[model samples]
Target: MKYIKGIFWLMAIACVIYAGYTLHSCRQRLANNPMGLELGFQKEINQTPVVLQSIERIGQWEFLSIDDEVMVDTTESHLLSPDDHLVRIYHGTLRLGIDFSLCDRGWATASGDTVSLRLPPIQLLDRNFIDEARTRSFYEYGTWNVQAKEDMYNRARTRMIQRAMTPQNIKQAEDNARHQVEALFRSLGYRVVRITVGRSS
Candidate 1:
């Protein structure tokens, strides 16, 4: 039992000494090399997937606005009042941008020092564009029903979207997206970046 224990301890000491020597040799060779790469080649690290996952919406534009007036006539008798109507001005702002969440497949690729990026289509970012509480009542001669006000809000929202989402605006957004993404790729050591934009983008 005593001899077995002694041999075990000697083997353990030899292993420790061999490990220290190996570590020292590795450090000395690394010190002699400028890049310290053991194989003299570094694996190309593709970060497109990671970047796409981290990104959400990009190229947000919200400058266009519309002032829509909704007029509602009263159903009451004409003898009681000469003219009864509700007039409200809906001030709505249209915001459009690219949704990166939809960029699930074939959005980006990288080969050598070149990167190819495809941006998603531009769309309305917000659902509730019109703030009814913020709507100003230009003139109100009678009480307006809830359904009429809701319909007016919907109409205003549709008109604002239609007027704002133009081909020129979509192209501008795509251009902005390309610039931003190219800069990002350049920062990541990419020499050339190619951008692909679809119809809606």
Candidate 2:
């Protein structure tokens, strides 16, 4: 009976140590990047067929951003007269998916009641998704002889990319793809669907 009690106490201590370590690691991860996944749920996907071609777009997101910039013309050797302070508004869309043109083969295969599939990683489908017509200068002041407006366009693109690449967006796209692919296989009468993605395999 004494031996049994000792064994139980040792097990309890081990469990407490493991739980404390897990909690501490999670806290440190959150402190580093609250949205980043230290371990991705799953990864892996790509390649497809005509049916995939029908999906012209997936994981579409529209975002609006405003940036304040100051361009100084150092060539003018002016303290302030040649500087332009500009506020610009950007309207953009981000799409995540596989490109049909890039898919040389189909992702789905079946043998009897079981089906298997491999998919390409979800990628940024469109980098030139900004609507220039919708973008406008919100506020502008000072000189015309300063820096060109080309940098402003680049800035807008950078901001849009940052907003679109959040962990939530990537996870949502992966979840959507999983559901869609599973449904497609099920519709074709596959009783067993086995999917291998990333390290989750």
Candidate 3:
């Protein structure tokens, strides 16, 4: 029994000493290398998978948001009756960003500490951005049919898109996407991150 107890105690002391030595070595290496990577520890060489997974997890990442209001009006004239006119104001918010679900299999590639990503170009995230409830009837004369109301709504939607989806806005959104993606890769310990905005996959 005495010999067995001695062996157990000896093993416990050896484990503690080994643990201390490992911790000290890690600290010393961390001091030498600010990156804090130890000799035996290996960072992932292929960051493509990591980056892709991270982007996908973020789902629809919105970079730019535009709020716009549009006024749409329509008039219907009758032969024997007065003309019917309707005017409405619509409010909507447009979100622009890249959808990771549209990314191709070869969207991201990594070479050593550098990573390159080909992402979809920034565009309106949702087509149905108009708030119907927020639409206010600015003016109404006579009775208006459902089709006329729908036409006015469509006109409002088109006008909003034309005003909000300008080339400058799209370029701004793309710049924001690049900045954010680079920051994300840097946080993942990548030394260099290259991103290209291309057609949606």
Candidate 4:
């Protein structure tokens, strides 16, 4: 019975010594590095301006696309010969949106969970929208020269632009851009996003 009791006492002392050594080591580490027990949350955000910078790196952001078809006909008359008539149908796609390259340094600002952005005005993304390969000669009479066909193509392109690039279409594209931008910011942890569409100074 005495031997068992002695063994138990030795085990207890060993446990106490181990606990004391652990506590002392912990104290020493804390003394050397005072912020070991920091319980506060880190509230500073580092991705505030990175969002805009990333967007600026995207060269052309297309928000809207309009498909248009235009028919143009031209006729050349000669007194001694029959009139040469050429009718063509042109297909084009008009892409409209903000050019991120135009975004200024002060385009985006963030405060807490709120982000404000000043984006460049939405405009036609590409002027050469016509698909020349898709141009179909609807009707042709007699032989047409290259210049005549070129003139008809120009007229067709102009008509398509006029028909597709209206004020209503532009407004729709702007609205879409706002929604897209808001969604992007919200996904990036921004709760409130304010966007303004205008020419950046």
Q: Which one wins on TM-score?
A: 4
* Full-model lDDT for every candidate: 0.69, 0.63, 0.88, 0.87
Error of 3 at 40 (Å): 81
State the weakest 10-residue window (summed lDDT) of model 4.
49-58
Q: How much does each candidate deviate from the true structure in C-alpha RMSD?
A: 26.2, 25.3, 26.4, 27.4
The TM-scores, one per candidate, come to: 0.58, 0.53, 0.67, 0.68
Error of 4 at 172 (Å): 0.5
- Give the 10-residue window scoring lowest on summed lDDT in candidate 2: 67-76
lDDT of 1 at 12: 100
Candidate 3: C-alpha lDDT: 0.88
Tens-place lDDT per residue, model 4, 1-201, is 999999999999999999999999989887887456657889986765534344333578788998988888888898999888888888899998999888889899999999999989888888789998898989999998888888887887788777777888888888999999999999999999999998422
Give the distance in Å from residue 180's predicted Cα in candidate 3 to where it truly belongs.
1.0
**Candidate 1 residue pairs in clash (backbone atoms < 3 Å):** none
For candidate 1, the TM-score is: 0.58
> Superposing every Cα of model 2 onto the true structure, what RMSD results?
25.3
Poorly placed runs, candidate 2 (over 4 Å): 1-77, 80-82, 101-106, 142-147, 197-201
* Candidate 3 local lDDT, 1-201, one digit each (tens): 999999999999999999999999888878877575436766667555534344334578899999999888898889999888888899999999988887889899999999999998787888899999899999999998889888888888888888888888888998999999999999998999999997532
Model 1 clash count equals: 0
Off by over 4 Å in 4: 1-58, 199-201
Per-residue lDDT of candidate 1, residues 116-150 (tens digit): 88766767677777767777876777666788778
Off by over 4 Å in 3: 1-58, 199-201
